[model samples]
Target: MNNYYILGLDIGSVNISAAIAKFSPDSDNLSISGIGRARTNGLKKGVVTNIEKASTSIRQAAKEAMKTAGCKPDRVVVSIAGAYTGSVKSQGIVSVPSGEISINEIKRAMQMAQDNAIIDKDQVILHVLPYEFKVDGQDHIEDPIGMSGSRLEVFTHVITAEGNSIRNLIKATNMAGLKIDNMVLAGYASALATLTKDEKELGVGLIDLGGATCDIVVHLGNSIVYNDTLPVGSTNITMDLSRALNTPLANAEEIKINYTKLLESGVSELQLPTMGEVSLTHEASMDIVTKVIYARIEETILLLLNKFENSGYLNKLGSGLVLTGGMSKLDDIRNLTSLMFDNIPVRIAKPRSVDGLFEVSEDAKNSCVVGLCLYGSGEFTRYEIDSNGELKYKDSHLKSMTSTKSVNSAPVIEKEKVEYKEDKSEDLIKISKISEKNAEDMHTFTKILNRLKQLF
Candidate 1:
């Protein structure tokens, strides 16, 4: 039995969360062993402002999680915010040399697509997800491995991030005594944890509203097609409240949480302390508080709505929109969102299920962290490009499948027997067996060539 531990860390502007999942290779279930969170101090709008403070927060979260799990995880799967992320769609084509497509042909096409993408010099590719495939004159071919085709073309959505920002995150994690197995987009991670397979296939939009940033992701046909971020979030509302009501930021946040409701409410008045002079107290109207919160939230939703409309995926979201994160817990957020989104179906969501820790699954704020665990436990794409930009096969964790076999169980195909002529007049014959999985470990040449200067 190959039972392993996967540690997922989501370091955001408001909080740094860590969760440990115990997974068995033979089963589809992921058991949550522990979870921990700490207030973040070194981040502003999800970008690390100070590596030392970020590392301290990461250490605190990881240490607490490990202590609860009674074991230290060697490598962690971390989530990167969408603030520094960008995505582009590209296509690659190659002739089928053997008149049939194989893994090599597929890899070549994906590498060509990566090469075709135009990006800034300071950015690194984070994910290369294939959304469509064309074989010869045919279009939308899912897998053309065994199909006869003269040319194989693949359309992929590539996600990239600023190199400096990624390096800073990596450095902070390393300082926290954790090696990163992968870095996933926080938006994509949240979608993975909250979205059902049917929703992905039918097209769905997910928004993760965090403390200082709102991350957007559109999923269609089992892959993310678009990813974006907004600099405004729940913190903006708090600031607006502080300014509008002439109150301290702490008190403003409390009011936003407890008093303000987007919908109508009867609680009309509250005793509020002055901003600079807390000793002096005054009565504040709940109507003003509600309006302040509503304005900021409405602005945020409109910005997100505009972004989605411009992405060309607005009409494609047949399954509608799903909202998660800390701000989604705000009173009447779903009702307000539905009204803003033209009454299209809107649902406030969190992690769909968590085996051990109920708290993690209960709160929408923990979506990204739980999704990181799912991603780490092989609950993502079948083929993925690792952080090192190598093509790797990931076993699907779907429960509907009859088998949960991994690459280690891949079939070994015997090579054709060969005979060698020797000068000694004796013929040597040999047969060799090679595993199909071994041939899939090919490096992405485009990334390697682009980063060759860094290797020196």
Candidate 2:
């Protein structure tokens, strides 16, 4: 039996988490094998600032996970976040040949979208998610193939990131002796772990409040329509507490994590420990702490709301907001978010349906890493470490099918020439019809022939 081991590595400003899982070819199920976590020092706002420190953290975390799982993994699917990531919605249109749309035509339309996207030279495309397809003048066509149409148009959300930031992250991971199989946006990964199919289909917003960055992704019409990251996150709250209370940074973090509460009923006074003291050695008015924390959190929420408004989808989120990340564990966060967003239904999201032994701390903070594992189990891409210790994409294959799968188990296979069978039970219709020539290779010729016949 062929078994594939996969790893998900999430490198954050405050912590690095690793999740290991195994995909058995016969069962197509990804079973949890092990997990590891370590404090990170080299990243600031999810970007690698010190390669050495980041590499050390990655190495330590992977080693610990390998030890726990009793199996070493060479490749990992990494999660990328920070302010450098950006996304834009673009559309592409192409004339269909023979009045029938095929998978090749869809690819061409997608390629046109990519070609038409105005991206900076210093940025790299991360993901291209199709929002909707249109045949002729009709809209909302999810599967345009096998449909009769003269023109096919596709709307896509293209994600891009700063080239330098991505390079730094890759270099650090390579230095740590781990090859990256693929990279996923942190917001999208978290949404995969926490969001339900109904929320995604009915339109929803996901806010991931990490230590140093807040990531947002909006889903509408069963696709991601908007994604962006803000520099402000829960760390700002700690900093405000530290500056206002004249406390050390470490002590401020402790208070923010342990003592700070979002009190909806508005408590008048509360007891907290003094600076440098472990016990409750001092009494501080709850109003003061409330002001400090609320100021920053409110600012963050307003910024996110402003972005959502600018995107023109603030009113369309029928499912409201889902919050996750390190700060989502804070007391009364759901209440605060609901109040700030005009009582829009708000809920704290955590990794669900996990099959492994996870610590209490892994509840909310480990969503990205666990989502990465889930993403890998559904995809069939291979990465290998080269002689120079750099991660290189080797090939793509069809991942084995499994019976027990979650809503997030959709395969993420890249565009490659691989044999696949038609499964009528699945949502995505597989292209099982093939000729002697590969679909990609014959696309242009087929289109030209059809055009010539029309001219004749």
Q: In lDDT terms, which candidate is top?
A: 1
Residue-by-residue lDDT tens digits, candidate 1, 1-55? 5566778999888889999988766766788898888989787777888988998
State residue 278's C-alpha deviation in candidate 2, in Å: 12
Worst 10 residues of 1 by lDDT: 405-414
Tens-digit lDDT string for candidate 2 (1-456): 566677888888888988888767566566678888899979888888898899999998888888889997634778888477887677778888688887667767776665456665656667667778888889988667689989888888877777668767776776786766667888877887888888988899999899888889998864678998878878888888877776667767876786535365566654555666665455567667777877777788888878888878889889999999988877677887888789999988887666556552258888888788776665311221111112222222323222222222212222222333223222331111112223355578766754453332
Determine the backbone clash count of candidate 2: 0
Q: Residue pairs in steric clash, candidate 2?
A: none
The Cα error of candidate 1 at residue 13, in Å, is 1.0
lDDT of all predictions = 0.77, 0.71
- For model 1, which pairs clash? none
Judged by whole-model lDDT over C-alpha atoms, candidate 2 comes out at: 0.71
